[model samples]
Target: MRRTRAATTAAITLSLLAATACGGGSANGDGGSNSAPKELTYWASNQGPDIAADEATLAPELKKFEERTGIKVKLEVIPWPDLLGRILAATASGQGPDVLNIGNTWSASLQATGALLPWDGRNFDAIGGKDRFVASAIGSSGATGQDPAAVPLYSMSYALYYNKKMFREAGIEKPPATWDEMVTVGQRLSKDGKWALGAEGSNLANNIHQVFVLAKQHGADFFDAAGKPAFDGPATVDAVKQYVDLMAKDRIIAPGNAEYAQNQSLQDFAAGKTAMVLWQSAATSFKTHGMKEGDWGVAPVPVPAGGAPGTGRNTNSMVAGINMAVFRNTDNIDGSLAFVKFMTGDEEQRLLNKAYGSIPPVKAAQTDAAFASEDLTVLRETLSTSAAPLPQVPQESQFETTVGTAVKELFADAAAGRPVTTESVKAELTKAQQQMTS
Candidate 1:
């Protein structure tokens, strides 16, 4: 749901017209409706291998809901690129789906606009209480100490993935426990044109998440207590420099990696050209690239050498995923709320996240036998014990772009064989910080 850039005019215009024409009325300001609703409109995020696949997976769930509630849902699975613009247009035009999917990172920004209903006591009770969700998942649903504006629907976090065959060949008995150890293992594994680490250098959101994890491990935050941009501090600069050094100084990253995005990195890992990658929801893509379950192993990302002992190894991963919200403008409050509850129910969480290869948000689903696999267990533990939410600021989307672009530029310079020093990273981060505040 975190697309790097804006949408085209045609896409915006077409979606706007559809939203206005169909949804331009009775945005549920009052709790009461003029009449009982027969059906509700739902905007689903693209979570399957394809749109059709998602529809197929959810068809039974929707049918069951209609049968039980006597209210139907008309579902539209929006692609990630168009979702934000469509939601914005709907907000401006007083038109949008009754219930929709939003990336958890956008919760605070959308809440600031007051376009989505806050999950007060009534709504929280409807969806099984706050206790039913993972604490980290609920934490990311809105601003700290405030009523959540959305409910966690799917959960994900970055974990280290290593090729088991490569590890055995290199005589590495276990994955690296710290970043310094990783560098050593990577150096030993790199031989005859094969590198040890692969990353999505051009994936803006992915890069931002990576840098956030690194910065947190080194005791840094992207914003100060006063809410100003704080991307150029000592720890932040060190984090970016170390990430860039994977290619420039360590030389364990693939050459020409600046052009590679998420898919390319996975492809490299699956092809045995790289030994390690940090990823979330990698099972499907890992298979698509011809890797079987037994071929790769998953572990928590390594911490800095001198960080806190037990928890630091996994503490820094951003508690990021997707959430579901109800539009304030919708007249079908009852139907919309009902659908939200149904979607977060035990059955639906398992069905949807299983298809998406993401962890379920519900605590019950986390313990279900469906999620008992080793990789899922590690991810569940990470979410429970270590994951931290992205800073819940209205300027978060801007932070993603500005900081991501700076890191992207660093990657570009490194790919071109320029010397990437800590000072150079600090300068780019300072510029990014300026852009965020301005």
Candidate 2:
């Protein structure tokens, strides 16, 4: 979990050309002054139409930006799950918004494409410099080979979310802080033949993030300096065993969980079919299918067995947020930077946090009463105190996907009553590492 400007090295100098154009990107800082009126196009997750409260709040902030900097932000919101494919296609064709919001995990893969603008003192002064964001999150956006290429945006992390009602019914006093305890409590809470652990199997990455956080709790680093697989180590093996045992040995999770992805289990959890789930903190707060505030509670991920006492790893919350970047090729670097600065500035972060329940990307904005009211202060606390970020390597995203996909399959095997032999896992992991390291 590292962040900051990488050393000026050849391997890291990504071009500022739009990746979609398949053209060479210029790294030169041609961003001009904020004196002129400039139109800046933005791409954001469609959290539904702008009528939604969260969606609607940006107007005031945008207006303020326009008045102050003479830059107009044309925001295009795309739903989270449905967005990646279109953005990738658009980017590959070298045409995308001058600034965009993207998942942190996507940073590495995107960096690999050799497009996107790098942030520095000249470009980022309006958005707060390296000092204002959480360190690990800042690192989440940088590639090891390059300078600090991206800035930290709003972020979220995963932990075990439990139904308070279910916990009360089971006579549990406090949330489980260890894997063994989760199994015991989950078993008790999951009754009436319903699944105890409702993991959406198709969403292997989310599950893996949870488990890997646990592995890191026990101290596992997946890749070394060369960006090679280090997953075969002891901590990781123990972590995988724990995950498999929850379903195969404990019989605590739902049946056929292998077939289910995030949406399925979210439906199950909202419907009260399961008691506990390891998911993003924001998932519980989602207002779909009648999800309400009192329905759930967030807890730190349980420590792995034999892990350090009083020591739990905050799996680096995926430093999730939309960053503002200028396409050097966009012909409006100053406009793009101005738009990014305004969109990610203190006022906007405070407003966005208030409207969307997002933790602020800039540290100066965290004092807002809105974050305190939503009680989302913990998300910021966790990212600062416990979480370690993904490595600042271009290969990190590919490796995470590989591991996530493997976990998905392995969990499926556990659900089907198949033996999780070491040989099988080693083979799968080896295959994944091969494709990635190549």
Candidate 3:
């Protein structure tokens, strides 16, 4: 029957919700006792739904939202592969969920369609709004001067995860603190069959971010205060070169990494094939990889050499997770906002993080000793001063593709003994800069 959360919402049929979220008033939407109290339909993505099939399965917080707002919320779990397309289709036809779970990076594109309302204005202030989230994560969710489009549900901060067992066995006294130490130790960790680093040759996004961290280490700003590409600067260029050399020139990375995805890197680390990996807060994959509790440790990304000697880049990093947004045309805009705020609030942040093992975006929850402990504490503290996001434009996803292609091409050239000069990279970034701006 494929009944939807919108259908389960107060006995209202999908047809009605389709009308409400889409801003179209279908006859069914305004008709029938099918609706006791007006309902708000929420479409959450696979990130949460993968752990729990639907909101009904995990509703302590959702129940609270329902109780406090007195508005029935129809929670729909849309698979990630299909999420953007389905939401776009529904919204375009004026028949979508009232609220949705969106990647923070998606804000610029989605907002371009004028499909959402910015939560930053005085129109709503439930969970502290901009102050509620770390700067980097919030910035990515489409910030246009006074109008920021989406609110954060939670964030997935990246950290360096190391195999303590491997480090101990190798007789390395402490985990590497700087890029040089990382490289030296990583080289030592590489054995007859194992690689030193979890990041392999492929995974261009990982490589690019590592370069970004390097750029930051050297005070390379991705964009100027006016928001334009700044990678043409020498510091940024150097960082990119260093990363390429690490894998291609230095040979510290594992073999056959070009074809490997992020998951493959995790598997290598978990299997003890690699000693260290750059991981996101969503390391539930750690346990899934048969890593025992405490088998691995987390640290802020280490800085490689550049800018100033012995100094790494700013600890600030771009946020890499999802945020929540309210559809502009929901039947119950007030009720929907209430739910959005509640989910992004401190209380819900705690539950969601604890349940899902992610970094909570709410500052208050980040301070919760119970939820944030040991190595994880760095997340909260660092988040205060060390968070950033990529450009919040409709073309961001496209931009990633452009940058990733360049990164991969550079790596391919390096691996095959081809020239990877600064001039070549500058030209590529120039083309990208043009594409991004135009």
Candidate 4:
């Protein structure tokens, strides 16, 4: 799930706390209607460059669904910043759409609310069985040893996107494979007015994603096996410091980026102001920004200097993607299931994933030629071999909120020329851990 700006964290936190306290009952009624409805509501995540672009891409497909199934889907493309808050509100008030798209990382958190329709044997059978999806995509769909709260829609993994022309001008032959090499290459590219890398410093989710991967490379886990936060651990502190050092100590990231809550970093790369960017499935977005197909190349995100990309400590990415979920109290359960089946069908999977520049989660659709591009090849390899899922615990959302904000503030200090020592990083992380325990 790509993020743009800071979410309404305070509101979401409060709503989530309330929902958890109440044990998450349905506000509408005891159950859904037995009969299918003629129309359904859907809240789509902003997968394209913007909401308008997503609308343009999905409208025709949705019309086709309506033509074939006689079910009109009322579509609303929700921006990332507002998507979580709106979903939380609806879960609490029982006023959400019939079907919605959720960031896959949030599956466990939302599942705890007891508001989403669980994909048990019956539900799985309705949508072509549970075996139709990729195992990696299925891993992040819900909590451990539980029926999934949602089904994977589009699969994605982070990769290093570099400008081919800039690399040639700088005499760099290939993308960096290790962090040391990245900093060395960055220093060489940081001359003149351009910087080596662009980043969304103030975006909460982006902050979490970067640090989470770095922590993994450092052999750290923010949460212990018992599901308690360990944010101030020695390895975790080192990971956070390393990521912020790209701007503070390495001087590879621009200082102005500390205030960039939106996708200004991507725009900077598109305009040739930055040499590279680490992003999730960004091809379609680049095209929308007027970057030609041959302008950029994709590679695995850099690993630790001596570490290789693989599972556990060498993981290079957090299993990233969007999942489709149904509200349990929706009046049109049958209609919602039909819509999900249509979206996850092989034909729609190929068409939609191709347009969005994402990998198809369906087992069969993934073999389509449209996804065999070099960019997707790298992402698919990373997803299968080096990606790790975020902690699938009920408190996962709180972890993202608290720790993500801590990193955001640390970036602000770095941009202001303050010392970002290991001690300072640990202190901030300690504060974040305290918020969860309190």
Candidate 5:
């Protein structure tokens, strides 16, 4: 759900060192004696098409919160590219907002810094008990056997979105249910300078998300059970090769897509330049691009030929979403908790998730009729039944950076007409694995 920079590994390592040196103290540098402030600074992730749009959507909600609790919230919607690095810098300096949004996959890696307030029993109780959140949403909140570093806010899962007009024109009856079917259907749909599939090939986070699912279908993981890098394993290599082949061998994706780091693929889908896109909770995005509701259809992402959609080898998506976390050194713990409570409240959950076209992590809010549309139903089912969380290890962020870059380079190679063979993919992955250690 978030992108990582090539320098992320060093940035995080340095931040960890700075946090260790700073020791524990209040965010204001007070000796744990500051009173709760009248206003709380909140760092929200950019959820809408742009930062300005997110600001517009959240303005009324924050106003409502201010009226209800008499606590004003100052909001800054940070873009995805800068969000993680900004958070790491804040952790190091002990100068961060009282609360912030984090990509669920970063929960464990960030928790290792000891800068976030842990959602223990007391905190969960303050926010109406942990049971209010869906289990799948909770699974990615932190590492196994530890207090969650944050609470689930939004829940999402990847699904295949196809243009119905393209399908009808190609004489295809349904979206693909398996990898082989996807290629076959894609071949039929690709013609006349139009691609069958669209991809953010240069996007580190998008590349990681796709390859992660492919690796799962191949009965592999980027990391082994012991949390060590296993990027070049046979199954993993096969999975990466298969994904690159979508452009290289299958020729369903355009070579220009190799440079698509922004959400160009989604735009292409909206403009009918492409037939299908694999995305997480993309309904809102489609609508924002002026795409009509009936123009497209949603289905589960394709799995392996014989595999049914479920956990492990059949997993079709990563548990994708955002989490809300409080800084442990915040000067206004009560106000921060109140803000979190207000944000996670049933009414707010329904309102915000609907506005953003995401599924609410709150169990009660999720059942609202607004979320019962066909597209949401497919995403909800995928999240509950087939999604797997990425490795909740401390080195997870580094893994995203190194391995994602490898896949990006491979895409570039494919675009340049170089063969994306298993051996070449394995070589790239091996280099990625070594970077993690070096």
Candidate 6:
């Protein structure tokens, strides 16, 4: 989801001191002389299934960058879990890489640190213009009316992924458009030791996203005006109840879902052990898991009855994608900015997202052949018509973890065959809401 730079051990302290001693280049004139080539450190997010795959995909592009600008970029592909901690360390030490990839949802959080350069006016002018990217995506880079602190590099949105074979066998003619219909359809489709839905119940990121989407469908905002979490509302409680009921009441989800992570849920759907899962940017991973393109179908996530329309409020998916930012204190600031612009350019975006099975952030790049399929078409439409950024607040990460842990607790009860009432769900949300303030 995000990526970037390093440890704060004693050895790292020496490295930081040495980096500080070297000093940064001035942001005057050409930024760097042609006779003396500039070098920039870049921290790339692990986009592919493995880090090597991302390195391989980016090699030629970095080579092209060198050829074009006489700037050599040293790339480090960081795993998701370690990225945020590394970034926090780097930001604190003032010894981070020149350019880095970050989760789009984290843009606001990271921007609050004041370690990233503002991509507005002249900086924006360097990379085409502010109008170059999709409106929703650029909007995600920072708070509204502020210069974006990062540039959207890859774009993604959630969608309902279902096994076509399972649906057909169950006599289901179409994907459900509402939550109630999904329950009915799932009941019919679940049998023979297989389930209708698979969830990454143990995964905090996955759990939080499901909660967000469902809560939005019920017209609940995780945060109210003034940025305080409003998680214990009736709508929020109902959403959690419905989610937990997939196992407890509906019996359409695997009992083992409590321990399942994102990959496991995806594997279950790919293996045909589950009929459906909510996923994003998983086409390549699914193919790698032995599923062919035609074997599965993609549809927008189902909302509740009387929920918002496709283009209406709370109907959008989260902007669960990554972004690129330049460190404000980089010696090679110009080169870092240039590298970011290069990576997010139309051609590079097409190449990289095609390799990653993701959508390009640039609006026109979505028209590429790699993105012309029916599935990606649905994702693209979601991005334009229905995608919303996660709540923009300083406490966003805390909210995610708190609510996610609460959902995990619900899952544990469901897995152990315990009844999870609406009241119980309310208690979990209330506990999470309290944690947000602490």
* Model 4 lDDT tens row, 1-438: 112233344335534544542222345422377344888889999999888999999999999999999998999999887788777776665667789999999999888877788898888889899999999899999999999989999999999999999999999999999999999999999989999999887887889999999999888899999988899999999999999999999999998898887577888999999999999999999899999999999999999778788987789999999999988877788888889999999999999999999999999999898899999999999999999999998778788889988999999999999999999999999999999888
Q: lDDT per prediction?
A: 0.78, 0.62, 0.64, 0.88, 0.86, 0.78
TM-score of each: 0.87, 0.82, 0.77, 0.94, 0.94, 0.88
RMSD, every candidate, angstroms: 4.6, 6.1, 7.0, 3.4, 3.3, 4.8
State the local distance difference test value for candidate 5.
0.86
Provide the global lDDT of candidate 4 against the true structure. Answer: 0.88
Compute the lDDT for candidate 2: 0.62
What are the clash counts of all predictions, listed in order?
A: 1, 17, 9, 0, 0, 1
Question: Across residues 239-321, which tens digit of lDDT does each residue of candidate 2 receive?
Answer: 66667677767888875777785456667777788877765545423456567877777776666555432324535343445
lDDT of 5 by residue, 172-282 (tens): 999999999999999988899999999987788788899999999888899988988899999999999999999999999999999997578989999999999999988
Q: Which stretches of model 4 miss by more than 4 angstroms?
A: 1-31, 34-36
Residue pairs whose backbone atoms clash in candidate 4: none
lDDT for model 1, on a 0 to 1 scale?
A: 0.78
Model 1 off-target regions past 4 Å?
A: 1-36, 48-53, 70-72, 79-82, 306-314
Per-residue lDDT over 1-438 for candidate 1, one digit per residue giving the tens place of the 0 to 100 score: 112233332123222333343232444432325254878878888765457867988788899999999887888888655566676666545556788999888787666656677788877897788788877788888787778979999998778889999999989999886888989999999898888988877777778888988887777888999777899999999989999898889888866778786467888888989999888767766876688989999888888776532344347578879999987757677787888899999888987787777899887877677687778877777777777778887666567768888998999998999989988999999998887656
Residue 227's lDDT within candidate 1 is 71
- Provide the clash count, candidate 3: 9
Q: Residue pairs in steric clash, candidate 3?
A: 18-95, 22-94, 202-257, 202-258, 216-313, 217-313, 316-386, 317-388, 318-388
